[model samples]
Target: MKKVLILSTALTSVAMAASAEEISVMSWGGAYATSQIEAYHKPFTAQTGVSVINVDADNPAAPIKAQVEAGNVTIDVVDLEYADAVRMCDEGLLEPIDPAILPAGADGTPAADDFLPGAVAECFVATIVFSTLYAFDESKFPENPPTTIADFFDTAKYPGKRGMRKGAKVNLEMALMADGVPAGEVYALLETPEGVDRAFAKLDTIKNDMIWWEAGAQPPQLLADGEVVMTTGYNGRFFAAAVAEGKPFKQVFDGQVYEYDGYAIPKGAPNMERAKEFIVFASQTQQLADQAKWIAYGPARKSSGPLVGLYQDGKTEMGPFMPTAAANLTNALPSSYEFWVDRDAELNERFNAWLAQ
Candidate 1:
């Protein structure tokens, strides 16, 4: 950080933000957005004297998906979503991570085995354990809390309108759980007629109370305004609101479905040599923890949480975010991009039609 530099999108460097070569990070764009580019990559440059630039993480403008498809990958580091990570790996758009290159610093972090199970199960490791929970305005539901996905659907017990994400991949697993399936059996059931049918049947029970959300901000607003007493929301989004902004809202991760969004080098990154260095540096446990502090999404390395002890300045971590919290793994969902990719069209069609009912 001694010889660092700083700069805004349209401005030049200010201080402690310098780096030899700038790394372009792919992520969302907005004012309150906690993009990896802005939070992790940008501050990393300021702190470690490394530099990173911001770019669109999704397709269309300088798209990573299209470029990877065209046999030329320009993005050095990518933030991969559930299926996106798997899709890139299968298509040879990601390079394998070699931890040996990324040595732990003075903190004795970057220790292996810290990442969540779903991430280690995949080639690309976890950067953040993002979850979808039934969030509510505590003021309205002062006497009650929604714990499980089943409670999410039960308007009788909960007794209020609900907001639902339109996307089916995560919701399907959730729907299955609400229908009385356990976490271990979610995927197994999806593989059978009974599982898929049971989930849809449960969803049909609350179709009337459901208000479809089109974007990430939709559910939060739907909750903040009391439009719906409870709704499915991303942990980071609610973390920003409830914890960071001190909003009177609470999120129940008891039956939450957690998803990982983290770094994966393109199969043939133009700057493979430099890309590898960035990956190793970014994956350092504390660095992941530092990034997590800004978002409240748990880091890949378990050491990050206990070692860093750096809570995001304002956010309150949901009980489940703690490594030893009382989490409801029984109803948790691990979205399989592979399965969704294959059955997306058919499954989504079936699920979306059911949502309309």
Candidate 2:
């Protein structure tokens, strides 16, 4: 149960007064975002007298569209991918935020600079940074396991079936990286004809072992069920899985792609004032640090707390299975979101054609 006194919990009366009227927060279900809501959002409501209406959706887009189309600005706040937020805002589906109303202390409001530089945007601030890594069950590979995407393809060496996300960005980047292009060069490679072709050619090698994961939840489920020894998805899902089930699976962040999830207010939100309050309440730096413990997603505010890296109590979570460790985070390659955002539709067309071929 949350402490009933909002003013006492956050050291502010602003949030306390706002909580009386409920604001709805839309997010993916399961332990993924619930932990943050419970630890952060719930407390925010309790102290401020605000009632937060939580909305859960497997695919959040349809409902957001429906809500907006229905002329119901019921979804006062949206926690969604940056791309969707940008698109929605471009479509006049989002509202600009006034940061002044966001909770602030003597030091001023926790600004975008407080977050990962990648997560800040015109109308949306990235709430977290999530990465996808190659994970393997340690016991399945007593000695040699896939360390990099190249190894993931080295069926001769790490010969179990491999898993990759059905999604395009990370998969494309990994294919290019595995084809011997340097990590830094992966994006530029796709910019050229040869690089794009090279990625598909490389992908052909393990296409048979590949299982296309639709939801972000599937890859981790694959690992848990022993369907495939290695797979990729949000590093948090796999990490949280291991933490939740005490599974033997591991994640390797080496050359993983990370993306910034943003906190956006829909355009013409009915409760615009309250939405701003929610964003401020959601991003308290201390709460971010606490959230990292429950969700593998790291704080956009890097200053939060000691995030689990490759080690827990001095043990390394590295190798092929774990991506959240510091060592893996250090070496991991990330996707070019700007490139993907710009060319994804074209790339998707070409990729689909290639898949058919």
Candidate closest to the true structure, highest TM-score: 2
In model 2, which range of ten residues has the least summed lDDT? 311-320
Candidate 1 wrongly placed segments (more than 4 Å): 1-20, 29-39, 47-50, 56-63, 70-74, 104-123, 267-270, 308-310, 314-324, 327-346, 353-357
Positional deviation of residue 298's Cα in model 2 after best superposition, in angstroms: 1.8
Q: Find the candidate with the highest lDDT and give its number.
A: 2
- What lDDT would each prediction earn against the true structure? 0.66, 0.70
Q: Estimate each model's TM-score.
A: 0.78, 0.82
User: How close to the true structure is residue 24 of candidate 1, measured as C-alpha lDDT?
Assistant: 67
lDDT string, candidate 1, 260-328, tens digits:
667777666666666667676677776676665566566666666665444455434443453234454
Candidate 2 regions with alpha-carbon error over 4 angstroms: 1-20, 62-73, 99-112, 306-326
Candidate 2 accuracy as lDDT: 0.70
Look at candidate 1 and tell me the lDDT of residue 100: 56
